[model samples]
Target: MKVQNKIVVVTGGGSGLGRELVLALLSSGASVAAMDINAAGLEETVALAGMNRGNLATYALNITDRAAVEALPEQVIARFGAVDGIINNAGVIQPFVRLKDLDYAAIDRVMNVNLFGTLYMTKAFLPHLLARPEAHITNISSMGGFLPVPGQTIYGASKAAVKLLTEGLSSELLGTNVRVTVVLPGAMGTNIAVNSGVMDTLEVKGGEAPVKMLAPDKAARIIIDGIENNRFRVLVGADARLMDAVYRLNPQRAARFIYDQMKALLPQ
Candidate 1:
């Protein structure tokens, strides 16, 4: 899809990759509606957008709230006439813990924000997307979606769901003008760990993390390219692409390899 002058709504646009994407889209001449549960973060994103008042708008929203998400299309249509695309980027990561050791509330939190939230947003916006001659949906899955790690069982599950769900959407939307793209991003320099409340309890933190992390701007560039080119699956960063290859070669062996790598990352 051509991004220039198109209306795009990005959930989690307040910070991290979402924030970077909003700025990147603005720079590319796209009109953007930065949606996030974090009102302050949305404001910060707007401030960084810099002198693009005509093309940028901020909406504080909880993507997990079904009613509000359902209302978003109308809101966007009211302001921008129509939407060309949506980036389902709102997500949260649970603290590192095995499934057996994890609390019910933590699991619920992760599933609610990471999985169901995307579902809600997709369902809400799909009808409107169908109205357009061509439309794009970008769902942010994770490297964990392809290769599960030991400590992040719930998060891995949620992202894996996103991966499959988006793939399925692609199949169902075939013959239509809508396209679905799922993005699996490797570890990047962002506040997702901190904002999701996992940083404080992360077993490994800082200094040469196991996966090579990219700056959000770099990731954003790759993502925008995928959307413009209508890629079905976008793997961000070398680590993500490498692991995707490993999993495709042998899912069992890849899972075991990732577990061993995770064990090595833990503090002695």
Candidate 2:
């Protein structure tokens, strides 16, 4: 579905990729309802919208809160008159530790934010999307969703669940007007670690090579293109693309390769 005249709702719109998606959608002539947990960050996103600000609405929301998520479509429809699509872009990563050493609190937080958050947003807006002549749902998974990273196993698990959930949703919605897409993004230059409160624990050794990350703006563009074309899956960044092929060819080798690249960031 084309987004040019549609009203799209984007979660995690406070900062990072979510903020970029809001700006990009506005530039593409789409009205947007941008949602985030940080009111200050949402304000910043609005300021960044400038002249396009009038075409956008900001909502400070926690997607993991089912009651709040369930009520969001009404508020967005009130602002934009109708809701055509939703992007479930909000998520959190676990601390860079092996699962055996990870706490249940951290595990639960990751699952709640990544898996349950996406589920709630999808369920809440699905009915509205179904009512529209054309509608869409986009979920952001990660490269870790399909490939293993030693320290980020649980985070990967959450994303892997999202990957399947999105695919399943697409299959179920097949013959319906609502379309679904799953995005698998590689490393992106965003403050997810600081936001997730796991930055302090994701330390690298003194002489290690700095990992390359894709710009969030570029990642947002790829995702928007996917929504416009109604693609079934979108992969962001060359790293994500290459890994998808490598993992498809040999899952064992891909696992080992990622472990080597990430082992330095793990605790000694």
Candidate 3:
């Protein structure tokens, strides 16, 4: 669906790709409701939006709260008149450790933010989206969702659940006014580690070749283009595209490749 004049809600819009999406949507003439748990981050996003600030509204929300999530459509409608689309982009990563060393609390937190949060937002806004003449839902999964990463087992699992959930939603919503799209993005230059509270514990190995990271603005553009064209799956970055093909051709090899790359971060 075309974004012009549409009212779109984006989770985790305080920073990273989410913030970029908000700015991009506003520039495309869409009214946006940018939701995030960090109020300061939201402020920063708005400040960066410049003149497009008029087309944007910021909401400080914890998507894990079902009650709060369920109430979003009403609030968004009150602010922007109607809800046409929602992008579930808020997610956190697990600590850089093997699953055996990972704590249940950490696992639960990742599941709550990544899987359950996406589900809650989709369920809450789906009805409103269906009511619109043209509406869309975009869920952000990760390259790790399709290819296994040794140190991020729980994070990968949560994203994989999102991948399937989004696909199922797309199938179920067939012939409806609402369109569902899932995004698989590769490594991007974002503060996700900081936002997810994993930066301090995340270990990086030196002497490893640096991988080119996708910029948030570029990623946002690709995602918005996918939404406009109503694509079922959107892959951002060259790494994501390459991995998608690799996984398709050889799932085992893809898994092993990712494991090899990430195993260095795991505790010896």
Candidate 4:
């Protein structure tokens, strides 16, 4: 569905790809309700909006809270009169550790934000989306969702759940007005590591992190394009694209390749 003149809700809109997505959607003439847990980050996003700020509204809420997520539809609909699309972009990663070393608290936080949060938003807005003349849902999974990333095993598992959830929702909503698109994004040059608190635990808090990533604006554009075209699946970066093909060809080899690359990030 075309986003022009449409009301779209974007979760994780405080910063990173989510902020860029909000700005991009506004530029495309879509009215956006940007939701995030970071009020300061939301304010920063609004400041960055400039002329497009008029079309954007910011909400501070935790997507992991099901009650809060359920209440969000009404709040957004009241602001925009109706809703046409939802981008479940809010997610967090697990700490760099093996599952055996990972605590249940960390696992729950990752699963709650990455998996259940997406599920809650989808369920809350799906009925409303189906009632619309035309609508769309975009869920952000990750390259790790498809390929094993060693230290990020649980993070991958959560995103993998999102991958299947989106595909399954797409299957279930066939012939309906609601269209579902799943996004698998490779690393982007964002503060996700900082924001998710992983960087705090690591020694490399400086600018010496390995692996250059795609720009957030570029990723937002690709995702928006996928939503506009109602694509079944969208891969945001070359890394994700290459890895997808590699994983399909030989899952074990791809897993090993990724493990070789990411093992350095894990604690020794």
Best by lDDT: 2
Per-residue C-alpha lDDT of model 3 across residues 88-110, encoded as one tens digit per residue? 99999999888899999999999
Count residue pairs with overlapping backbones in model 3.
Answer: 0
TM-score of each: 0.95, 0.98, 0.97, 0.97
Pairs of residues at least 3 apart in sequence or in different chains that clash in candidate 1: none
Candidate 4 lDDT by residue in tens digits, 1-268: 9999999999999999999999999999999999999999999999999999988999999988899989989999888899999999998887888889999999999999999999999999999998999999999999999888877889999999999999999999998989999999998998887888887554543536556689999999999999999999999899999989999999999998888767667788
Residues forming the 10-long window of minimal summed lDDT in candidate 2: 202-211
Better of 2 and 4 by lDDT: 2
Encode model 2's per-residue lDDT on 60-140: one tens digit a residue: 978889999999889988888999999999989989999999999999999999999999999988999999999999999
lDDT of 1 by residue, 57-100 (tens): 88888888898988888888899999989999989988776677
C-alpha-based local distance difference test score of model 2: 0.93
> What do the candidate models score in CA lDDT, each in turn?
0.89, 0.93, 0.93, 0.92
Candidate number with the higher TM-score (2 or 4): 2
- What is the RMSD, in Å, between candidate 4 and the native fold over all Cα? 1.4
- Error at 74, model 4, angstroms: 1.1
Q: Stretches of candidate 3 above 4 Å error?
A: 207-210
**Model 2 residue-pair collision total:** 0
